[model samples]
Target: MYLLKRRVLQFFTMILLGMLLLVLLYSIDGLIPFLIVIAIAAPLIVGWQILFDQVQPQAKLAWLLAVLFIPFLGALAWVMFGRTPRRHRRVKRTSSEIRMFRQAIEMERIETANAVSDRFPLTRTLQKLGATGADGHTSTKLLVNGEAKFEAVLRDIEQATHHIHVQYYLFRTDDISSKIRDALIKKSNENVTVRFLYDGLGSQEIGEDFIEPLRESRVHVEAFDPVVHPLLVFNANFRNHQKLIVIDGKIAYTGGLNVGDEYLGKEEKLGFWRDTHLRVEGPLVRELQRLFIENWLYAGIEDDKETWDLFANEEHLPEYFIDEPKDSNGATQLLVTSPGKDVTIRDGLMQLMMEAKESIWITTPYLIPPPELLALLEVAGKSGIDVRIVVPGKGDEWFSFHATEYYFEQLLKRNVRIYKYNRHFIHAKTVLIDGKIALVGTANLDFRSMYLNHEMTIAQFETSSVQELHDAFLKDFDESILIDWSILRKKTNGKRFVEAFCHIFSPLL
Candidate 1:
């Protein structure tokens, strides 16, 4: 009832404003104002229907309602926030820098990569979607949680040879982060080249004072997508959510765990931070290496000649480490998803699910999915495919938690099994299919990740990697609380109201 009343009132206000504006314009001179309105309004009205083809139906309707009700004001809002315009000079400059920076890392592949693609049709589709291909000669380790991941990272940092490249969305100065920083400083003093990258907006808490020691130690520290103008909020929407660590262009690491004490299960508010991390070797580390360089240069850490300092330093450089594949178990591809890309991480996940004949298991910290994804899962469930999803019982963000809960009933009706990890806040983002292949990375199943942010995911076809992920999923499922109909119906009226309100804007959020 409140929703209806709000809409009714907004519509009336729109009408009143339109009438008042028209009268004021006529009192002065109607000709110019009327002609301008006719030209703009006529095209906007017709072209909006065409624009609907580009966006999702719900998002399209939201844009339509704003335009019809608010008229002139709505048009301004649409231009500002409704579209992802890439015409801005800053955007063009950033793109050019990325192209220039990307040239530093190796991208060639061996023969086995092509063979893997031909053998698996889905990998071909994923390649077309993400502009990535499989690297057959590679090794992987499925790290279960943050503690395991950080321990491995610290050990690897201590053993660094030629160079080290590390990036994270969140870079806190907590105990864990401080320890890692000290290790990097130790490496820098050893004359082994080192570069560290962080997202500006996500790691806003890290001050210049925090990073001063690294700079003084001669370590190249930079931030991606830094806020250029205070008035420009749109730039803030696009974030570098990718967490990557590459050692000497051979060893690589990625997953949900960022550098922080909380991630190591040391924060009291969240008892344990359940997550996953992967350590990869072989041709694919170069892919992660390429992404790190792309961001390091784009962040304007430096410009002009000698732009490839991160990749190359002629003076006092150690030989690049040769991290051969521990075993050629199967193929792995490092798939990158970002704004202005060919397709997306979401597309790859959907294609992966289409190949599932036995079961589809998923886990993520957030669950704000678009309608098409919701429909696909419903259909898959009806077809008797084993469909299961694991999410956090308690989320770090309150609004995100309710927005995820909002889709429960719709999914329940279609027989999709939903489980909430009750022991702690689980942040592992993964997709496993048929016990043969898996996806693990930083992209969460939400609008921000799918449509706006820059993210990464590794498609693993290795039997060992897939088996480990499958076993982990089963363990998490065993410890989870299944969300059946009765439990959902027991929600209080106040909680229901809050969730309902949050659901209305979940897509835009």
Candidate 2:
């Protein structure tokens, strides 16, 4: 009854706003010249605001030019949708009970990396970028493909004794995912607390029929930032793209793989899906679980929780919340970037580029990079750093691929070698720097992952982990076809026009 009433209230509220906008426009029907003036002046004003804002000069110019040219997407829609905006902002905040739980379990996000291994001068710049630094003791393993990763993850879920916290951006209702769901349901039947949080937009295909079985088995199933009303879901940019699975607060799994048959290479259209994931043991699960807890809180959004919290407070904080970090099995740290946060993954990646001495190897499915990142890559390449990048040979997204190609000529001029993986889609989001630090997780090197979405990137200073990624990158290099600047620069007029056209909207994407 409460949920229905709240949803009804939300629906009417949106209706009222729509009617108000309609009435406002209706009232101005006779004022055609004035409206036309507003159409022009409004864009100019917003474009100016975008220019003077903290954004980079190149990006500001790009957006400014976009606004000046793109006729339909005027100032109104630009501010409403094009900005690094979020639709999930409202749902994540309403659940005050979860908020209280988060407060109770919150711990100081400390740098747990040991100084003896992670030397001060070497990691100084990284610390300034808000990295928790490296710990040599925390053990990590590199899981190459989806089958191996999910197999290990399912085993862990089955072995979970006390509680399990699982979160993913894409939770499909396919073969691999069904197995996962059944395992979770089985665990829930065993009276183990199983909390599953999935992105509302990413898992939109799974209806109540698919989820009811889990709910019936006492599994705590929730959707993150669900679209309460279609009218409110203007932009699906701020999706929770982080894949986290923590069991009993000790072990966790994260990486590029989502729950789908496609991820397991069963889908013929995408062919062999090549990706990377990590199996984390030791204290790093604490941090990974923290990410899950916070999102879980956000997913459990409720309106009445604000008043309910003051009197019905019963905190079930984890034991690790108050415990101090000591030497763990292996050393690892997380680079978490979410919407509405001061820290960003961009700053950290830039710092790493600035600090690189030898080489920087990158693998991403999407290549639409922000100007700052593009400039940094160029600078890194020109500075005698072996900056090599690998992107998909066939783009899953048309506009994004063209937008990626638009930046290729500049990068090639700087001697930054770019490769296109010819065989299969390389979905690994990883950065190997100087053979010293390796970063792996879900955050892509695109506008959406860099600024708009919730992302998790774990960095390992452990020698073996770094070596594993380096070796994998070298193997991928074997199959990739290198780009020839001479051939690519001579694209036909129509192709060039489309590429440039796509580049205009790349920032918003």
Candidate 3:
């Protein structure tokens, strides 16, 4: 196959480059300096492996052997293979704060649950999902696309009374983004607290000068995991992909919609972007508000009493769910996972897939799942449960698109029905199991999202929500092209090989 040949060629090329560089260094006549550099680098590489071995044993073995055999070449290999500490540090901070915040909310949830259990008789799954208690005052609205979601966002901002907290993966400086920026500025001038958080890497296309006007208006603006520093540039691999907006701690919006021309379908190249977002009102908004506060604090912004008061509930009772270290409620578990964290969201997803009984429905833009996850899906399909996945027919990233196709041959053989959206790019990340539970969030079923990015997903236990998700899945199915195994088999060998080569670097991609 061409992909296999490419990997073989790439492997040899790397070897040749490494040997040439080493030979050149050896000829420099300054053997002592070269040896000294190796001496310093070897231990650092070893130490990093030792730390990683505790969590990722496979990575540790790969790195440790490389460093032990060729100290100089191994050092380079280690940098490529090793986990990034800068990202690890941010993960540590965020995870710790989220755990603490979840603990603080436990008691309130228990009280709310006890009161609501008599009425709703919360399902075991819902109880496990930490949704045992229900708050009557809260409302939820599902927005189908970016246009609807952004329109709602504008409406919410216009009505902002005390504070507005907005965070997104991509916040462009285009017309749509400008409209929201203008609203934030107007609110700031009206003495309303306004803060905006955008991913540094995701918003790289937009210049800082574009945001200067909002800054001049006294609206707090910060970039999450900025790559401005030389040493931190590699940290760009791990991004804050969560799109959240909290208004006065009473309303919130979250989902796949990012502030960009592509998302709004304003970009001529990519027309009519399809996505999903949810506008949440009631007690759940408090949790969303707390999430924003954690990010705000991470950005070195202070949370004042006035801002804290917005989170304090005096009228509407909120049912809170605490994220326990161990899975307590079988019905639903709030799994928050990040790199260097104990329970990863990807691991949770894997567990969910493995546990599937009757059916599994998934929607994601990218579909570069790990080997283990791919195996799980194949095994699940073999067991006769209806397994289906919806992915974008056309994507923003061509490499990722080709990479996703590499698995189709294997998946089709196992009887998994893969659907490609024909209308537009499907950016929604959601999974539904047996029409009983669903996960909705920014995380995609890709390696970057699973192992590298800081992602968020909400596990929904409510049957109504699960049904809604299922209905949406069915509707999307109607709009998608069912990929046939025969079709994949008929692809040109060159194209197939290209897909396979792209698949090879999927772990790093």
The TM-score values for the models, in the order shown, are 0.83, 0.83, 0.78
**TM-score of candidate 2 on Cα atoms, chains taken together:** 0.83
Candidate with top lDDT is 1
For model 3 the TM-score comes to 0.78
Residues 99-143 of candidate 2 have per-residue lDDT tens digits of 565565445344544563455354445556666554445578889
- Pairs of colliding residues, candidate 1: none
Q: Please give, for residues 382-447, the per-residue lDDT of candidate 3 as tens digits.
A: 889899999987877767889888888788889899999988688898898778767777888876
Error of 3 at 188 (Å): 1.3
Backbone atom clashes (below 3 Å) for every candidate: 0, 9, 4
Better of 2 and 3 by lDDT: 2
RMSD of each: 6.3, 6.3, 6.7
In the range 1-509, model 1's lDDT, one tens digit per residue, is 01223234444654575577677666767476775676478548644652754655666666666667665756544553456523343455567666544443232333235577766667677777764667677788899998789889999989987788889888899888889999999999999888888887677678888899999998988777665432333455467889999887778999888889988788887788889999888867766766776676667634533254434343312233243665667778777777643346888888878778988899988888877677788888888889899999887776778889888888888888999998779999899988888999998888767876788999888547888999999999999999999999899999889999878767655
Q: Which residue window of length 10 is worst by lDDT in model 3?
A: 319-328
